[model samples]
Target: MSVLPRTPPRVARRGRAVPVGGVLLFAVGGTAATIAVVWWVAAHTGSAWSPGGDLAVYRDAAQAVRAGGSPYQVDRDGYGFVYPPFAALVLTPLAVVGPLAGYAIWTVLSTLAVPAVVWLLVDHLTPAGDHRRPTLLAVGTLAALPLSPIAGTLLLGNVNIVLLALVLVDLLRVRGPQQGILLGVAAGIKLTPLVFVVHLLLTGRIRAGVTALASFVGTVGVGALVLPADSVTFWAGVLDSSRTRPPGEEAYGGSIRGAVLHLLPEAAHGVWLPVSVLAAAAGLAVAVWASRRHEELTAILACAVTGLLVSPVTWYAHWVWSVPVLALLVARTWRRPAHRRWPAGLLWLVFALPLPWWVGYVLGWAPLTEPAWMMPVDLLYTVTAVALLVLAAVWLRRTAPAARGCPR
Candidate 1:
């Protein structure tokens, strides 16, 4: 089949047997209802958090952009607003609306993205004729909502959820050369998704990889043209938090590299460096093998998990990959004799709880003396992410040769 469709497809898309409007109504309506319900409960219970805290920084950057100034001047979590100029350019509209109104729009879109991701995964990965796509979509979105990654993204008003949706639409929905453009725009805003380009190349989608790279460069070029000073400041490494704060000191960082380094007393880039590199190499190797075996979803997921592990400073927000990752696992294992399905449930429970935050409360995050017991809890997502990668590779290796030709 051609990647580009010249006319309306004779058959409807795999995941969109239902109309898009209906899906949006369900997703957006459900998400908004959940918010209202939660707010009502919180009001009665005297417990609540103001969502869109991070949008304040976004607004600050957007204001700077509107004033023809540099966005890198703003701070986020004690670090600089650590994104490319294109990201600020994208947020410029928020400045026009002001922070409160911006949060309203961003939060609504972010909520829509949360369930849209689930819709995409269910539409693509679930076996046909299952008759449970919508149910699973709703369940998966609800399951993901309380999980730290999605929850933190929603509460903090971050870009991770939207970026997840962008990447998913690019990979699962887009059938043309345009497949890579969304992913490229995502990577332009945050560098982690750039790893998908390498995934495309290793899987023999060389054209897709090249297109993604070109799109990324085009974003940078646009940034340079529109926000020359800010783009130069960013590209010159002016806003790099890693430059001043050693990886070990980033207690909130959930990457394997950061978690391991934090446990040590001194700066150990050498120690953390080789380990994360090796982990990434192994992950990409598994991803390549899965691609060769035609386990395309597994291959795509392996790359996503690998990116979370290897990024210098992954946080709870970056683990937004967990929702689809878990959903894919459940989809592949459901009603199958070849593999057990219970492990996916176990993983869901792990991600659903605030394990690290519980540990933080115990350790009194006062300058954070992460004791031995706290290490595992603090490293919960990182270690599990690494294990999830290894386990996926192992499961792929164990599948019978006869089953190798089918894409799962």
Candidate 2:
């Protein structure tokens, strides 16, 4: 018999095998480009930034925990390790490996989140035999790699990706007694995801919501056992929101509060609080409306944006929720008519381009020189967040009558 070349093997995803050799190459190339871009930022950012500062903070916290000390005690006011005590307990292994090894592991895990998120989106939104799924997942992964939020999260060693993944999985796939476990654990690591607990309750997912609450308590109990002092300090509000880094023009701190601070003035800063509250309430109401109509992705994303807007601080990395937001918009509108699809394209450019960070970088240009309106451009992501809330409300209102044959 004539010798024959073996066929390339396929990888299994949600029980379906996909021929994804091209995607692997694209992922590798995209990662190399992302690394090069980070080096460029390191060489150019001057004293304005400390590359890997967040990672350093994490390592320091881990070291403190490893030494049988409190991570809270090591805070020196600048760029502190601001996560919950349970996070420090979970990160203890990073101390054992040391900084360099820990950083490498972190990078691999963070990069892997892009594809993992894409896979989850694909598996949930598209049918198993959909011919376009592999391509869409690969393309989405590459497109997400360089979003200001995603790239910044990688640079900062933030837990946003893990939280995003946890939230996505819990809502999209998990449907049993274990459904809420991931979201609860995520909220334990960082409290922002508590908004999802609200999301679950209003959407009639009472069991999952209660289970998630229990899981959160479980994490806190574990933290108390492992690092009682740190847990006590954190629960007592040792890390106040006011002590966080300034929502200034130098970085992509694009919260609704940050926007109000920049656009108005110091005297107007207090307005952001009530503004955040109103925005969050409106966003949550829209989320409830979407969930009632079986618009699962819309409900989750509405809550995501609400959390970001209502947060005390929303750095560029916090916009990591954009990945799934984009994935959802594209999935819903990619093959529709131009009028229906154009919004997806516009939103893609909003994230895919470096516009928000460019707004930050350009402020340093002497010619620009503190023009009154210059700083608000840094609020691109923030503006998009607000726009999403409005869009969800309006769209849901218009579609309510037809969705599930339910009356508006």
Candidate 3:
């Protein structure tokens, strides 16, 4: 069976093309710039910006589980373990080492996940026979490492990259009946990835969807068997607080819901929920439309973007999905006429800049400033997400076969 549909012939019928050497040189230069910026931030911030504070939290949660305590209630440095019970169980091996050692180990693993995800995206998105695929993956991953969202994930030692790799591997690499298991495992670790289950169902991969759902249920069953009380506590709304954005986090939280709360009055925060519902509806409709056109990657990405936008508390670290989005945009633009590919170049510049969470960093900055100036800066991430969603719709329509009608 075909691993992926062939790139539309029009993509291969290119006219003027970008010079590969220039692209590589620019990528290397961008990578160096990112390193300088990260080094500057680390030096200025000192240990306040130390790596693995979040990994340390996960380590403590794992230790709690090992000691027959409730991992759900475990908190370290005021950060609670917001992941599912199975995640704690999975991390239990870390308890063998001290927190510092665990941090080092997690940092190495998470760092490696960066390039791994890059390879997965490049390998799947580009033609299998393209010689430049390795170079593309290397340049993309190097450039991505310095981006605020991806860099922040590395600095904080989060599992978002690992989760991203799992989803991409399931979609782009996996074969046979077990294809969806990794996706389910990812969703079990963090609930946000369940959006892929919806994607699979909409795309008519019923068996794979059922397999993913069962794998998720299997994780819950394992948790129940190992720690019955904690399982009950987690499944109930009690552990919901674990996933809630901390008070004062909304300013730079970057989700549409978070942006809505920041821009509106306190009472109007309730409006975010309804707005999120509408966004989810629209985003999912786009995903379904892409799926109907046999654009599997586009469908999956639409769902991923939707989940990020609709979630109440998507932090900068959770934007690892942006890496895949960048790869897709670059690929799409590579296939376009030379003059029409400016969006790809503009977007790369946008992602390369340090994300401006400074307004939030400077307390009361929003209120002190005029709405005209502050509102756009505050909603930068949300705007980027909406733009990507629009791009996905445009690409779907442009690439859809003439025989297939656009969704109404």
lDDT tens digits, residue span 286-308, model 1: 88998887777778889999988
Cα deviation of 134, candidate 3, in Å: 2.2
Q: Candidate 3, which segments miss by more than 4 Å at Cα?
A: 1-50, 238-243, 250-252, 337-340, 355-378, 402-408
Ranking of all predicted structures according to TM-score, beginning with the best and ending with the worst: 2, 1, 3
lDDT for model 3 comes to: 0.72
How does model 2 score by TM-score? 0.84
Q: Tell me the lDDT of candidate 2.
A: 0.74
TM-score, candidate 1, is 0.83
Instruction: Rate residue 236 of model 1 by lDDT.
Output: 94
Residue lDDT tens for model 3, 1-408: 122235455774673454667765665565555445543443344243334556767787898998989986776545677877898899898899986567666766776677788878777766566556646766877767766667777666678888998999998778779978999999888888988898888778899999999999999888889988888878886435325544444455667766877778575467877888999988999988877876667778899989999876787678888788877777666756789988767776665544444223333333333334334543777888888888778767776332342211
Ranking by lDDT: 2, 1, 3
User: What are the lDDT scores of the predictions, listed in order?
Assistant: 0.74, 0.74, 0.72
After superposition, the stretches of candidate 2 with alpha carbons farther than 4 Å from their true spots are 1-19, 32-50, 75-77, 246-252, 338-340, 353-378, 400-408
lDDT of 1: 0.74
lDDT of 2 by residue, 137-181 (tens): 768888888676788777766778888998888888898899899
TM-score of 3: 0.81
Q: Which one wins by lDDT: 1 or 3?
A: 1
